[model samples]
Target: MSVNLYRFGKTVVTIILKPLFRIQTIGTESFPKDGGVLICANHIDNLDPPVVGLTSPRVIHFMAKEELFHVPILKQILPTINVFPVKRGMSDKGALKKGLKLLKEGEVLGLFPEGTRSKTGELGKGLAGAGFFALRTNAAVVPCAIIGPYKPFQKLRVVYGKPIDFSQYREQKISPEEATEVIMDEIRKLISAHK
Candidate 1:
């Protein structure tokens, strides 16, 4: 019924980023006008989230690493940026729950299926966590691909792939890891095209 747009994210996105990047967003129309969506993307630059956010006309919420949440200014602004924290390694129950809650509330949550940044800025191995969330929450999965080295003033193409139904996996009641793989693989195919 509602799309959760963060208070700070709206302002920061418009003010800090809109003028700087030549962001080309593809397939945004594919996203459901109102529903939970997991936006799984590749991680290369620290700027990935904002770049993705600005490129998107819709507001996207992200589960950031605990490390980034500790920084003072970022700590305050991150949450406003619609960014929340997640502990890496092992299962972060808190983060997962929060992500689910956001989705159930009709928020678009962003995730790096790659889990970590690519040292060489290429597509890396994707963690199935995002897919797990999709299956568990019964949310649509939007696979996005961003092509361009992480550099400012550089024109880049952020390709938003079609929103795929994970209903098949849901019907099978597959394991979370298994479901995650299916979701990540879709994201991988999108990434492969750009790479």
Candidate 2:
């Protein structure tokens, strides 16, 4: 690949994604400036990851779908941008291992608890993967919400909630329902503030 492609991607991201989408980040003070953390958020649009990443001052490693990797052009620079692929639905142990390793290595793991984009324009039920990762790694879980349609020439905001401790899940061995409720409550609050 020529150096031109890399230059072109950076230019497009800066010129297009940046200028077109006016992003506002609030409560970023809640994010741990340094350390391994499981950053989970609601999934409304595919743009959520990049919007959150750009807003977050901390270096974040994103867990994107494996299908996006099919792009020959993107394959060149995605790595430099800190994006990774995860096989949706199935265990995808490879992705799990990678996610855990990133946390263990003291890196931020960007995840979408809903697992996929919401089809009905309402917050969908979140999956247990985020909980499983948080429990396994003992990383702080920061609930975030990407609030808006995020179309070109439109302004959007991403709200980050404080990191929640999950030690109880490991010690008390509470039911999954309890853990799910704990998470949804935080996510709900983040969404409500945007409206």
Candidate whose TM-score is highest: 1
CA RMSD of each candidate after superposition: 2.9, 3.5
What are the lDDT figures for the candidates, one per model?
0.77, 0.77
lDDT of 1 by residue, 62-117 (tens): 88889988898888767655778888888899999899999998878899977788
**Tens-digit lDDT track of model 2 for 1-195:** 234543454456556676677767788897887778888888888777767766776767888888888889877667767777888878789888988999988888888877889986577787777777877777788988887876877877788898888897768876544665577678889889875
- In model 1, the runs with Cα more than 4 Å from the true position are 1-21
Highest-scoring model, lDDT: 2
Provide the clash count, candidate 2.
Answer: 0
TM-score of 1: 0.86
User: What is the alpha-carbon lDDT for the whole of candidate 2?
Assistant: 0.77
Q: Give per-residue lDDT, candidate 2, residue 64.
A: 82
Candidates' TM-scores?
0.86, 0.85
Q: After superposition, how far is residue 16 of candidate 2 from its true place, in Å?
A: 4.1
Q: TM-score for model 2? A: 0.85
